[model samples]
Target: MSGWQRVLRGMLDILYPPPPLCALCERPLRHFLQGRGAVEEPSLLCVACEKQFAFIAGEICHVCGRPWIGESCGDCLRRKERDFLFSRSAVRYNDKMKELLARYKYRGDRKLAEVMAFFLQQAWRLHYAEMKVDCLTYIPLHEARLFERTFNQAEEMACLLGKRVGVPVYGMLERRKATEKQSKKDRAGRLHALENVFSYAPCGKYDLPERPVIVLVDDVYTTGTTVAEAGRAIRTGISGAQIYGLTVAR
Candidate 1:
């Protein structure tokens, strides 16, 4: 951001202060500001609400990153082939996370994108800190769905995470067609529906490195079908590409 941009943002902040209540529970926060003359950082969730989040920890599946006692999850074990190198997520998709995602994704509560991006950042630090990441891309929405939603939640969160990690984000993949919502589908149905749904279409402005390492960002990883198909599309376009998946929830 430029100096004038900062000045403009400060002016706007003073003119229109943020709400005093938490986003989730609407509880009043005790310390909402960083300090005097600093930007007021509104808390997304209160202490009690934050405690309800289930961060993924302990042993996890090597391929799918799901919390598991064994080396690989049942989903991975049953699968014959995998496209992405691996996948990892920050939190378990519990009731609290599902509610939060619904508000952010379907209800257009965009402020929650920051919180979701923070979760992605934490997942990156934990899982991909040492990995070579040439660029970050997101699971793109079809134009129809994008128009309906007014924004791609995955793209928004990916941009925020890229800024924090100092990586360049690009629209390297495109959704070929709109399909039925994956949430309602079984794993086999999801995989079948997602076939040929994605195609590689890199941004023209930037040239990706040879044999690039790309991370696919999304809001959630349920059956892993979405990211897997996306990875396959990318591989078709860029041979020897190393693809990985990073999502807010699993």
Candidate 2:
């Protein structure tokens, strides 16, 4: 941008200062709660607002990232096979998270990518930090949807995560089938819809690592079908691949 544009932006920032507000709840974050450590870095949400998010921690199902309430979640136990080693998410898909995602994704607010990626980084630290994650890649968007949305939310978050975590993000996957939206579908419908949806994209000169430990990134993990399908497709293209799933919410 030109210097004049930069100056104008600075003026605007001074006139209408960016609010130090929580992303989920528009409450001002400037007020530090009493007895809390004020020296700590400020997060995207205020203490009270942040408390509202149900962060996924403790014993979780390896397949679905849900709290292990039973011997094994029915979804993971019933499935005879899965391509990905495991899947995990940062937070629960609650109304607050949904609203944040809608603003970032549907409403074209790209700045929220950083906040979303912050949680993703935490998820990685909790789940995949010790694992040998060779490279990171994100779920692809079909051409039509890509054109309509103008930006891939998953890709944007993944790039930010890659930078934060020192992982090399690669564009090695593509959505070959523009399947129907899975949000409204039931488990069976979602499973059927995701079949053969992902395909491997050729990477020029970036030779595949031997028995690569790949982590597939996505915005949300409703059911494991999408990531499983993606893992299957990637394994088909690359030999001896171990796939894993990471998402912002479960």
Candidate 3:
């Protein structure tokens, strides 16, 4: 950047200083740093707050990638045929994860995108990186919902993960309308409500990548209906493509 631009940015920073504390605990990050070497790293939460994030570590379902007692989960078997090859979540959607999602998705903390994306990346590395995902995409929000939320949290995290992992993020799927809020419904209700709620043209020149595998990113995975519908839409539109789902939590 030019010197004038630098000077202007400095002046602007003086006029509107950014927060230097953790998003959740509101503690200054410097207090948690281990040493001078740690000062250069960026973090949304302090060490204590970060520790509260419960990561999934043991044998998981071969399909949904959720913690399971056996080799495969009954939910996956019941579904039998699914749109995506598989899905994985970084952490169990416990109380801490809920708070993180609430702050980022409901409270409009855009800066939290970095932290969430980092967690998703960790999940991918642990489970799905071997899939050789050619492209990264997100479950798009409906126009009305997008307008109401002012941003798509999934897209933000997808873009960040794509940049970090050197994959290209694409707008491959679009929601048809503002369907009933999934949170308000049960699993069956959510599945019924999500049917045909996304539109995609897999054959479109801009839709398909040279590589066939794609990873779908989202903030959370609940009933698996939304991503399954998205994957179905992609497969219906494009032939011989593989789909995978990644999320910060399940």
Model 3, 35-95: lDDT tens per residue?
1121233656788887898778688898888998887788888885678878888888999
How many residue pairs clash in all the candidates, one count each? 0, 0, 0
lDDT of each: 0.86, 0.84, 0.81
Pull out the clashing pairs in model 2. none
Q: Roughly what TM-score does model 2 have, to 2 decimal places? A: 0.84
Model 1: lDDT of residue 44: 58
TM-score of every candidate: 0.84, 0.84, 0.82
lDDT of 1 by residue, 161-186 (tens): 99988998988889999999888987
Which candidate should be chosen as best, given lDDT against the real structure?
A: 1
Tens-place lDDT digits, model 2, residues 154-226: 9899899999778888877888878887898888899988888988895654555799998999989987888
Clashing pairs in 3: none
- Can you give the lDDT of residue 5 in candidate 1? 100
The parts of candidate 2 lying over 4 Å away from their true place are 1-42
Alpha-carbon RMSD, candidate 3? 5.6
Q: Candidate 3, which segments miss by more than 4 Å at Cα? A: 1-23, 26-44, 201-204, 207-211
**Candidates by TM-score, descending order:** 2, 1, 3
RMSD to true structure for each model, in Å: 6.5, 4.9, 5.6
